[model samples]
Target: MKLQAIFVGLVIVALSLFFLSPKVNSLPVGANVTSNTSSNWSAAIPSRTDAGGTITTMVLDAQSQDDGWKGYVGNISGKFTLDDASGYSIYDWSFTVTEGEVYISRAASPSWSTAICANTTIISNEQNYFGMTAAEYDIINKTFNETIHQSFRVGVVDIVNSSCSSAFTYVNDSKYPYINESTPFQEVLLQTGTDLIYAALLETDNEGFHTGYTYDFQAIVPDNRTNGVTTTYYFWAELGT
Candidate 1:
């Protein structure tokens, strides 16, 4: 009876430690702008447009609210902006990313712009965004000592003019590969961290006026677990240029 009692006590103590341990601080998922301003234009690029507009930068804080055992586990919070440089209020954006976790961004054309143009081409596409996974991201941090994956997303917004349409496309060596036609909202999973990611305003096949638009980018990080220890999940984004 005494031996059985000691075993039960040990089991209770082990369970307590498992539930009371501090989680590791893993690298956050999603895009986070450490600092942002108009003066920092090296990383910002102009978009092809007919309206002659300029690009503006802003930051947003993104967070996720899904609870699961493993899929899509992390908070997406960061700063990104609107790059409107094409004369027509259209802009292109890009980012260099590292591998750590899967990330996603959401874009939308607000209700206020419905009257501005009904036939606008405001769709979320992926062909404009680029990504590549790097070997450096495989390094295990002593703090967490777990593997991470890096990913990014490009969102499209406010393309409502029937004559004008926008899309996300992937370009390879200056040649267009894939194009996305869905507007205002789209999502992509970036598994590779070796290449640069870009977002651009697509031209209409029929040749028409380019309408105004807006978009947001986000990065996603996955939960980290090892040896029965799990890290607190977080999403972050870093801006360049």
Candidate 2:
């Protein structure tokens, strides 16, 4: 009985040591050091659209600071017209891109459209001119630079539009009426330890018929990869009036 008790005690001590031993280290040395190295990044060729009455295309342009990755960092331009005679307004835009690359995208207009109108009392349900007053201006302006930018992942090469409600803003709020957009700075950081292509598309619905309201759609790519290598990709935009 004493021998059995001694054996049990030994087993307990062995198990305790096994459980309490220090863990082995496995990460590479200086993995947290920062370096600024220039790379050979290029912008994908841009496609033009005239469906919105005015078509504008801006190249994705970027510069590497201390060897950082660079490409496009602003809005791609597009336009459409609206007339009050018709109840429904339709605008379509699309961009073609390489499959398997990650990207962050968003849509934004100038502060003029986003600003509140001077007359807050002008309100109506069937013809809410107050809500659409800026849209009216957008039609008259014919075209403006509204940018949607996204970051360092890959998505399949395909067409994206505002009709794809998942990819766009669907609300009537004054802040973002036309498209849903995000930047790569937010998306890529969230997706650490993964490699893939990403792309984004944006669009808006026509509330009324106006002769010259236009929306300009653009996509931008900003690589956030730590390793210094120039990445190349392409995207195309098509406007559906």
Candidate 3:
């Protein structure tokens, strides 16, 4: 029995290793591609793998019966470095950042090509002062800096970090990309939905500006207030010089 079992295992391994074609006809059963961004997976699992040969969408964990009215506030920074096996910074490897992107999202990797977040301050899609449940408005009006959001649906992106001496934004806004311009203090009405959301990470640097920056950017995310379930927003970044 042992000999037979061993032979079967070898055959299975051999088939998995060498018998399959270089390209798979379809993703193996139960293949869980966790990325739900609008763009299809590149190089690995193209749309042809699906039966329809069309782009497949992996929708997020949509939730209802809960208030979409919670807030996150934070600063984001990045380090572009090459590390040795021991993780020591290899300074000679050369690293510089011309710009950086920060994403406040419920998805681990939001799409760079798609502006999944639906809020923007450019032209008011939502009015901050209204379009809220009385409960939500009352709660925010009572606690958060209502002055930041003002009575506007969307505010200008006027983030500043010129030097260690200038005022910088403490948080980021959940807004659309593409048409977004880099500024700080872009405020919009509290968006309502359980769909996965993300925001453009505005750059705040000490490039001739006031500065006390630990990180390169700041952002915020809205979440569901379901009891016993703490919302988890993923923060992702990319840097280039």
Candidate 4:
């Protein structure tokens, strides 16, 4: 695989809350609903070509208020225009997301490191695999002349009834347990031949498989000294794996 580098930065609002007082009438099952938030974020990915456009995202967590039909949708979607971008190229993109949540008494930082990985194979097999190690992150930071937070990891948890049938049946296929920064930062490696990004970033499923059980993605990074200060630039995107 050929690796070409282009630096693109994104600002995302993480851990923001929307105050929605429960209504007398609940949202209908399977009905698309949006949160009452005014926050908007923009991110960009450099393509094989030099020209670029805008990538916008609205972050929210939505679900039906029914007990029997409980579901999760990490309501994150992006719009982009990579000029004549070929599907077979690797993109070096960097994104920022606020690292803490606001509360009544005090703000709490993320308990784990979080990332969003693009399951490219779901759209095209020519694009395969996404990988990033601490070493690579170091290089990207130095190359871009930037300082990014190195903390916890956002892992793809097991979904009980993933819309992907095969994935639903074998929910525990990946042996990786959700770990925090006190433990070493393990690398993220997903290959087209074995895994797919179901719905949320940091999630993976058996190659050539998918499910309907969509969800929001997050990791537990805590407010500890050894872990460094929490900040934006807490997210990453990998094209293939």
Best by TM-score: 3
Provide backbone clash counts, one per model. 59, 59, 18, 23
Candidate 3, residue 5: Cα displacement in angstroms equals: 58
Over 4 Å off, model 2:
1-197, 203-224
lDDT of 2 at 176: 47
Q: What is the C-alpha lDDT profile of model 1 across 1-241, one tens digit per residue?
A: 9988887865534343235445432222254435432211133344545455767564755543322112221222322233223424233444332222222223222122121211111111221121112232321111112112112222212222222222221122121333333332222222112221212222222112112321233212223323354434333333322
**Distance from true position, residue 104, model 1, in Å?**
6.3
Judge candidate 1 at residue 236 and give its lDDT.
Answer: 33
Give the worst 10-residue stretch by lDDT in candidate 3: 24-33
C-alpha lDDT score of every prediction, in listed order: 0.26, 0.28, 0.35, 0.25
Candidate 4 error regions (>4 Å): 1-73, 84-216, 225-233, 239-241
Q: On residues 2-43, what C-alpha lDDT tens digit does candidate 2 reach at each position? A: 988888865534343325545432111111113333334475
How far out, in Å, is residue 36 in model 3? Answer: 26
Please tell me which predicted candidate would have the highest lDDT against the true structure.
3
Please say which candidate is ahead in TM-score: 2 or 3. Answer: 3
lDDT of 3 by residue, 1-241 (tens): 9988888865534344424435422111111224332222233332435677577778555434324444333333345454444757756334444354444444454333333224333112222322434455433323223223222111222223221111123322222222222345333222224223333333444221123323344333344344555556665444434
lDDT of 1: 0.26
- Among all windows of 10 consecutive residues in model 2, the one with the lowest summed lDDT is 183-192
What TM-score, computed on C-alpha atoms, does each candidate reach?
A: 0.18, 0.20, 0.33, 0.18
Q: How would you order the candidates by lDDT, starting with the best?
A: 3, 2, 1, 4
